[model samples]
Target: MLWVKAFHIVFVASWFAGLFYLPRIFVNLSMVPPESVAERARLLLMARKLFRFTSVLAAPALALGLWLWLGYGIGRAPGNGWMHAKLAIVVLVLGYHHACGVLLRRFESGVRQRNHLWYRWFNEVPVVLLVAAVVLVVVKPF
Candidate 1:
């Protein structure tokens, strides 16, 4: 159980690192001036590879989380409201991840629907979600 918990933490941290960074890349991507073909291409490649690697990391993190919750019964009790809140945040995080993919696709298609400032704000979403999740788990304030 401890080993599982440890690995889960590691994977989650790694996944969050990707979540934190990919958006910064998007910010840079959005800021890239037209005619900088090589820079755009390079940024796109980095975003693509990071997204793929981050996705790979997310799978094990989520799987181990489920294992901890279901198999280990970490949050099955009646008073585990913190767990419920954390789960909701997880869903939001997943949605944010999908949104990132969509944004990447749009960028790939040469759509510049949003400015860099918007992406800068967008990049902060996961940070807040991660903080909430960590607090929920560690403090269990519910």
Candidate 2:
């Protein structure tokens, strides 16, 4: 159980790192001049690779989170309203993660239409989620 908890923490942190960074790559991608073809290609590659890596980290993080919740009965605990709220936030975070993939696909196919400022704002999503999640877990205010 302790081992599973440790791995969950490590992978969740890893996923958050990717979540925090991948959009910043898109921000740079959005700003790259069309004339700078090579640089744009490189940033695209970086975003794709980071997205893939985050996908990998997210799998185990989610699995362990589920294990902790359902398998370990964390969700069954009384007065765990905070956990439910945290799960709601987790769902939102997952949606944000999925959107990153969609946006990455658009960028890869030369279909992305959003500007850097949009992505700059998008980059803050995980930060807010992270803070909310940590506070929910640590403070567990019900």
Candidate 3:
């Protein structure tokens, strides 16, 4: 179980790395001038690669997380309200991840309607989710 926990932590960290960096890429991409063809291409390549890698990490992280939950019945057990809240946050995180993918596609399609400022704010979404998730899991306030 400790090993599982450790691996889960590793994969989650990797996933968060992607969630963090990809948006920053978007921020840069958002600002790339239309004349800067080379810069746009480079940024697009980076975004595509990071998105794919992060997605791979997400799968194992999610699977291990679920294993921890269902294997020990942590979420199903009583007084596990914290676990429920954490799961809810995780779902939102997944939704955010999906949104990032969609945004990447839109960017690839040359849709830069949203400015760098928008992506700068958008990038904070996962950070908040991470902080909230850590607090819920550690404090178990509920």
Candidate 4:
């Protein structure tokens, strides 16, 4: 169980790295001038690879987290409201990950519906989510 927890922490941190970076790539992608075809292609390739790797990391992270929660009953006891809160944040993180994929698709399809400023703002979302998740887990301030 200790090993599981350690691995879970590692994978979670790795996944969060992707969550933090992919949007920054989007910011760069959005700012790429129309004439910079080579640059756009390069950023798209990086974003695509990062998204795939991040998704792979997310699988182990989620599986290990579920193991800790259900198999080991880490937070199954009564009044463990912090776990529930953390779960909600996890759901939001998943949604955010999906949104990144959608945005990437939009970029791939040559649809520049959003500007760089929007992506700059988007990049901060995972940071806040991570902070909230850490607080819920460590502080358990419910």
Candidate 5:
């Protein structure tokens, strides 16, 4: 159904938006001086909240993606290379999601230092991967 497709697109967009922004929080957290207790707490709280909200959308996006792939034959999308690449990126994104959870837990437990520049650099990774994914999905460029 067109409505299902629309919901899928909206939810996917929401998920990506959060994915893109999550690392920026890390970047900000890294910039704050290590001794700034209040600032550190605030940053950790923000990251936790954002991750939780984004995860809610992500689960459904994954479910709906699978549903559409099966129900609407998206697996039959013409280009094997593009489809394969997209699937790989999807796995990478999922990895990043789980990694975020792990990283947040480590930080919350005071096992890690938050560095702004490191997070800024980390932010570029998902952006690059997502760009490739978008190209594969939209242009199907081989």
Candidate 6:
């Protein structure tokens, strides 16, 4: 149980780290002036590298999380409200994570003319989702 809890903490923290860093990357990318092709390339390269590393972290984080849940959670606490809510939020977070990947690829593909403002607005989604996730985990509001 202790090991499972530890893995939960570690992986959840890593997931949050990725969540935080991704938005900052978008902000940086959005700020790059139109004329600085070289600078844009550098920023894009950095973003790609960061996302790649985060993607690597995400896989293990997700795996360990699932292992912990299946191995420790399901039978241990029957009809757990918070756990159920957290699991649902996890799905939403995963969806957002995949969306970020699509956006990353779009950015990589030189597909300009996207609604930058809309993408910037979309950055808030994860923040709200993360907050809800934390609340579900910590507050356990049943």
Q: Whole-model Cα lDDT per candidate?
A: 0.97, 0.94, 0.94, 0.97, 0.82, 0.75
Candidate 6 residues lying further than 4 Å off, grouped into runs, are: 74-76, 113-117
Every model's TM-score:
0.99, 0.96, 0.97, 0.99, 0.89, 0.83
Segments of candidate 5 deviating more than 4 angstroms: 77-79
After superposing candidate 3 on the true structure, give the runs of residues whose Cα lies further than 4 Å from its correct spot: none
Model 5 agreement with the true structure over 1-142: per-residue lDDT tens digits = 6877788878888988888888888777666676899998998999999999999999888888778777887756665577788888989989988888887887788775656667777778778887888788789776
lDDT of 3 by residue, 5-110 (tens): 8999899999999999999999999998899999999999999999999999999999999898889565677887999889999999999999999999999999
Candidate 2 backbone collisions, by pair: none
lDDT of each residue in 13-114, candidate 1, tens digit only? 999999999999999999999999999999999999999999999999999999999999998899999999999999999999999999999999999999
**Clash counts for all predictions:** 0, 0, 0, 0, 3, 0
List ranges where model 2 is wrong by over 4 Å: none
Alpha carbon lDDT of residue 55, candidate 6? 76
Tell me how candidate 6 scores on lDDT: 0.75
**Residue range 1-142, candidate 6, lDDT tens digits:** 7776687677777776776677567666666678989887987887788777777877877787778778766424755688888788888888888877787777777766445577677778878887897787777787
Candidate 4 per-residue lDDT, tens place, 8-122, comes to 9999999999999999999999999999999999999999999999999999999999999999999889989999999999999999999999999999999999898999999
Task: Tell me how far the alpha carbon of residue 81 in candidate 4 is from the true structure, in angstroms, after superposition.
Answer: 0.2
Instruction: Tell me the lDDT of model 3 at 141.
Output: 92
lDDT digits (tens) for residues 1-142 of candidate 2: 7888899999999999999999999999999988989999999999999999999999999999999888888756887899999999989989999999999999999885999999999999999999999999999889
Give me candidate 4's TM-score against the actual structure: 0.99
Better of 3 and 6 by lDDT: 3
Which lDDT value does model 5 have at 91?
95
